[model samples]
Target: MGLAYIFLTSSWWQSAFNFLSLWLLDVPVNAYVTLFIVNGFIAPAILCWLYSFAMLLYEKIKNKILIPSIILFGAYEVLLIILLVFQPSLVGTVGENYIVSRSILTLIFTIVAILIALITGCILSYDALRSTVPEIKWKGRFLLIAFIFLTIGAILDSFSWTAIFLVIFIKIILIISVMSYYLGFFLPAKLADVLIKDIQ
Candidate 1:
């Protein structure tokens, strides 16, 4: 949806402002835009998706802890819709580069939604890490770290493609970490023991 927004809604620029364009003085506008859309918009959207799945899993495993987390994340999703509707950005004439989102309500909702998502996401990850099942418990820790880096990368990467590449490099390492878990799950138990050393 967000990517469609970028391609479908093309507009001329007043000095080409994107989430990262202001800070990144040297990079091309296309790189800046690509990073902003990929990291800033798509990343949070993916988090929303993963969190929803996490809620379902946690509900089965940890119902008591799941309730508040669901509520917060649900509210976060709702506000995210509001943000999408408004489409935050700097757009206007040369002298007056005002915000594209006109309603202050939308702005406030976006900020609040971000805060709710962040806090509850970290909490949920922590609770998941506390599971007594050794496998789940350790995976939970990795997930918590992944979410933290994902969130940071999502926000910071928007400002520059340099940051985006850095984040991607880090996440690639994380992907390898995660693949070992899958290997541990699917491979022959004896082989798994040898092939997949414990990461956490």
Candidate 2:
């Protein structure tokens, strides 16, 4: 995700003012447009699919609705990879671009993939929340909040410059939330028990 943001900032230039600067700098408009489509759009779309897979794995291991989530996630990844490889070229005139005819299809696929990822994330979050274990409750809450922030960030990208900044802020929050959840849930219990026994 950091890689995705770096690509967006350095190559795509998210701000409208930065976009205008391209004209003064003598950079081809199509180049920035292409970078936006490929890195800003497609790469993050692919990451969402990967995230769904990770959630599917967690569900299966934790004995949730394993098979269906895995199958759906796998299908999503396949579709995302296919769309990424066959992306319509933004460098040329719209109708003349390669894969132009398939643009609608790609868009539909991406939307479906995003929806699947969200659904899977919700299921995993719910499972975590419902666990009798205290550690898992905290982990689940973090996951739920992370996904909520991520969704908000994605929506913010469609709004103004301030919204874009909010998106970046939410991304940071999501990352930290997930990291802290894992560290707290996976490490503390066993390590604390070991340390207690050694002290005795």
Candidate 3:
């Protein structure tokens, strides 16, 4: 996911991609427009990340729905990849820093992707929060916060905001999301103990 951001937003990576496209395809790729191709991959990356969180939650609760959810998400990701490969233009167009989806198909896909993340987060957090186990509850708290931040950041990022401050703020929120997600799943035992003790 970080790599996707780097390639999509970083000027250096954009330049590299442009150069590659020009050399390979014998035409200059619009650096911003090229983000259409890059954005397609981002959705799949997000789904994969969400899946990891779901898997961890499943380990704690042993939910039967996780399997079906995985299959559905996998199919959705494959559909995105297929669309990207065959009809990238139908996905969307980028102007400045924001994207304007080209067709209803792309818009619907984007909405579905967001909903998938939200539903997964809600399920994991709700179940974990209900657990009598303190550790599970703590992880759930972080996961909930992470998802909230991520959703807000992603929405804000989709806009072509001219304000520099807005862009910075969005990036900060996204960074927080990543950090919170990491802690949710891989928190250190000692730190977790200390925090749980304080809360208790």
Maximum-lDDT candidate: 3
Better of 2 and 3 by lDDT: 3
**Model 3 regions more than 4 Å off:** 1-33, 46-88, 97-104
lDDT of 3 at 46: 50
Runs of candidate 2 exceeding 4 Å displacement: 1-108, 158-200
lDDT of 2 by residue, 50-91 (tens): 544455555455434445545655565465455455653422
lDDT of 1 by residue, 148-182 (tens): 54445334322323344664574464455344333
lDDT at 180, model 2:
44
Candidate 1 colliding pairs: 20-159
The Cα RMSD in angstroms, rounded to one decimal, for candidate 1 relative to the true structure is: 9.8
Residue clash pairs of candidate 3: none
Task: Estimate the overall C-alpha local distance difference test score of candidate 3.
Answer: 0.62
Report lDDT per candidate: 0.42, 0.46, 0.62
Looking at model 2, the pairs that clash are: none
lDDT of 2: 0.46
TM-score each candidate. 0.39, 0.44, 0.66
Q: Write the per-residue lDDT of candidate 3 for residues 1-200, one digit (tens) a residue.
A: 23423222321233356668778997767633564554555555554545465456555653454556567656765776676678666656555433233446655655565556667777878888898999888888987888788777766655456677886797788778778777777778997899899997
